[model samples]
Target: MKAALMYGPNDIRVELTKKPDCPEDGLILKIMAVGLCGSDIRNLTSDSRKGNYPFIYGHEIVGCVDEIGPKQTKYKVGQRLFLFPGTYCMECDNCISGHSENCENEHVAKLAGTGGFAQYIAVGGEKIHYGGIYEIPDHVSYEAASLGEPMTSVFACLENAKIGYPDTLVIIGAGPIGDFMASIAKTRGAKRIIMVDLNAHRLEMAKQFGVDEIIVSKLDNPQFAIDEVLRLTGGKGADKVISATPANATQAQSLHMVKKGGLVVFFGGVPKGSMTELDTNLIHYNNIWIKGHFGASYDQSKRAFALACSDDFPADKFITHILPLDEINHGIELTKTGEAIKVVLHPWDESFYP
Candidate 1:
């Protein structure tokens, strides 16, 4: 099968490999759709990691089960499934505490880990234990099902937020993650959700997603935008501000937009050593809560998968481009250049999209 792999920096090669075997209790998946994420681009550029070289980089993945494990319990052949890419060992301390996303065991990721760019890949036992293989509802198309990962991450942040009905929710950045956070905020019954972004086009796109207001930070000045949100909330800034952009600057901006006692969720993946400047007085005097969220819990992935496949909430608008796996470079470039809102890589034939 043909697989797109990362040999090193700026080197994504598509080559043939022996078809992966299905794990004893796992499933062999035929790659259908995978989303190209900002982190994938970051791996190619600013924050590349070592040791994990010659690896497959995709995490937002959806596929149909080709070969089922002989001792299958919940999964079967011919079923479409979503993946919780970060495999975790069930016996670890974190896993015992229901934080399986951080299991210390290497096999947690399994031998045949996230090779979603390939035509076929195997899932591990930890993945299955964590409900990693969620059945894609028959009603959901492959394209939309691929958004499960992003939605799960957004759900994780919201869970950390402890949002209440009619609370004002502010989301920083209008990228896919930001837009997703906005949608999640809306679904949670936020009375006023303000979406902040530098791209006017994205703000316009956010309008289509039903945000209460759109703020172009570079032009409208984000503080002014926050003031408007406070006005909308009767002079008490947003109840919660979720910073979903990787930029450290946006983290500080979230502090400014949230009220004195408001909650702030930093959901973006910032590089190591990145720092955001904040007011020390506010930290000492005000009772604001700044929560940091990382990967999604396995249970959250179930909800996110349901949300992804649901049309009532609607995430089709999130997918702005689709390209064949062989043309993955174009899709990744779209993310780097901000030329595409969301890019779905199709390992299957192109006819499925057009």
Candidate 2:
């Protein structure tokens, strides 16, 4: 099997590795397509996974069941599938309370050096029974199905905010995740959608994706975006604000961008051990609600897959580049330069590269 192993920060090499064996109670997937996520870039640039170096790390996976375990009865060989990525213990306190998304003993199926970056990954043990795999629909393209995992988080965030008709939704970040937030919010009947970002080129590209307005934020003058959001909302502020960038400035600006009694979702996470100073008076005097979102629930993952399968979701448009597995470094660079929206890597397609 050929896998891209992360040796350290900003270092990745593609080399031959032993193929993972199928778990007695699990299965092995021949990875077809895997989408590069923002988290992957973050991990690549930092030592967050220092001790776990030289391991595979992709999670937005779409593959075919190459080999099935004898104990696995639900799926058959050669069936195409999408990964939910994370699994949880049913006996955990969070799982018992029906909030398995917060399970204390959660296990990521992509871990243990058998992630989607490889040509073949073995998913076995408790992960199969706890829910991390779903059969892909025949009509959905592999590239689109690879986006299901990221879309699940978007669905979870919107569901938490209860965004609906006549709500002015503002998303801070013009990347793929922010675009997903805008797309889902539109389907939920948001009256107006505004996107803010530091990249002017990214914001220009976002216009075709159903964003009602785009604000080019200034890193030096952070208040410029706040004023622009207020001006666009007729001085009332947006009804809901989602800080989709992993920047402390944007996260703090979300509070001032939303109207009184509105909801603010911190969709992007800041660096570990870093804290932002926010005005508590805004929450106390204006009756604001601030929420922090992380992973998605099983139900949200299912809904995200169904939505990706639908014709209305524009899943294909989200994919801007497709590359071979060996070119993983180039793919990562494209994402960092904002030259690509979503890059899907085909682990087995060594002959084709774009």
Candidate 3:
């Protein structure tokens, strides 16, 4: 098997590697498509997490079951499936409370060593039992199914915020995740959806995804975005605001972009040890709620996968590029330029490989 091994920042090499064996309680998947996520890009560069050196980095995965563990009765070989990027212990306090995303003992894809940037990955042991894998419907393309992981977090955030009719929703980024937030908000009956971003091109692209308004903000003019959001909401501000970009400025501006008593969801994470100063008086005087969200629970993942399979969710439109596995560096560069929305890598597309 050949895999893109990440040695350090801006260093990923595609080379022949030992194929992962099927686990006694799990299975081996031959990766079909894996989405290049923003987090993956971050990890590739400055935001590297503490993990084993030279590990694979992709997580948004859709693959076919190549080999089934003898003890794994839930699925068989030759089945197409989408695997969630994170795993948790079902016996933890958070897991028992239905918040498995925050389980005390949890591991993401890179930490689990089952990254999908390769020909095959071994998934087994307790991960299969906790239900991180789902079958892809025959109608959903492998490229679209690869977005299930990110979509799962979108579902979890919207469910937590409870955005609905007559409520104006404001999203603080125009990237793919922010676009997903806007689209899902429409189905939840949000009266209006406003998107803000620094990239004019991405904002233009977001117009097609049910965005009611777009605000172009500059780093030096954060208040301009808040004022624009207020103007769009008839000076009352939005009922729900989501900071979907990994920038502290957007997260700070989101506080002032919401109406009194409204909720603000911090859906994107900043670098470790980074801090942002927020107005606590806004929370105390205005009765506002600020929630920080991360990954998705198993139930949320299932619902997101089902939504992706449905006709209403435009999964195909979100995919802007598809490249062979060996072109991972080029894919990462495309993502950084804000030129691509979702870049799906086809590991088995040997025709395109050089």
Candidate 3's C-alpha runs over 4 A off are 47-52, 106-114, 351-354
The alpha-carbon lDDT assigned to residue 232 of candidate 3 equals: 80
Which runs in model 2 stand beyond 4 Å of their true positions? Answer: 107-114
Please give, for residues 13-69, the per-residue lDDT of candidate 1 as tens digits: 888878888888877888888888877777765426575777777878788888878
Candidates, ranked, TM-score: 2, 3, 1
Best-to-worst order by lDDT is 2, 3, 1
For all candidates in order, the CA lDDT equals 0.76, 0.86, 0.86
Select the stronger candidate by lDDT from 1 and 2.
2
Please give the distance, in angstroms, between residue 105's alpha carbon in candidate 1 and its true position after superposition: 5.2
Clash-forming residue pairs, model 3: none
Q: Cα RMSD for candidate 3?
A: 2.2
Better of 1 and 2 by TM-score: 2
Give the alpha carbon lDDT tens digit for every residue of 172-280 in model 3: 9888899899888898899899999999999999988889899999878788998988888889888999999888888889999999999999999887888878999
Residue range 1-354, candidate 2, lDDT tens digits: 999998888888999999988888888989999999999889877886856778788989888999988888878889998878767665778878866678787254233223889899887766777776788988788998998888988988898789899999999999899988888899989989999998888888887778999999888998999999999989999999999988888889999999999999999988988898899999899999999998777777788888988887998788999999988999999888877889999998876556
lDDT of 1 at 55: 77
Model 1 root-mean-square deviation: 2.9
Question: Model 1, which residues run further than 4 Å from truth?
Answer: 69-74, 88-113, 219-235, 350-354
Cα deviation in Å at residue 315, candidate 2? Answer: 1.0
Question: TM-score for each prediction?
Answer: 0.88, 0.96, 0.94
